[model samples]
Target: MPDIKCSVTECEYNSDVKCGAPMIQVDHNNVPKSNNSDQTKCDTFRAKG
Candidate 1:
């Protein structure tokens, strides 16, 4: 299988190799609600370290 690169720079899972999981689950509601509905962020994000 091809490697998955994590987009989050703080996540230890993020590496030049691949993401630890085949897929990551993210909740949109977890993101802080903002006036700019177009904006998005992952509240569940955690550094692998």
Candidate 2:
């Protein structure tokens, strides 16, 4: 797969500044639609144990 960069160090799916998941889900943080990066969230994020 192409390199998918990620900066969430606390996520279990993050690997060396990249995403190791087969796929990632990005959803709007609250509103129905997102107009910017800050308005969105990584739904696939899982805290490292």
**Best model number under TM-score:** 2
Clashes of each: 0, 0
- Per-residue accuracy of model 1 over 1-49 as CA lDDT, tens digit each: 3565656667765666456654565545544665553454544466776
> Cα RMSD (Å) per model?
4.6, 1.0
The collision pairs in model 2 are none
The C-alpha lDDT values of all candidates are 0.57, 0.92
Q: For model 2, give the 10-residue run with minimal summed lDDT.
A: 1-10
Candidate 2 lDDT score at position 20 = 97
**Index of the highest-lDDT prediction:** 2
- Structural similarity to truth (TM-score) of each candidate: 0.38, 0.88
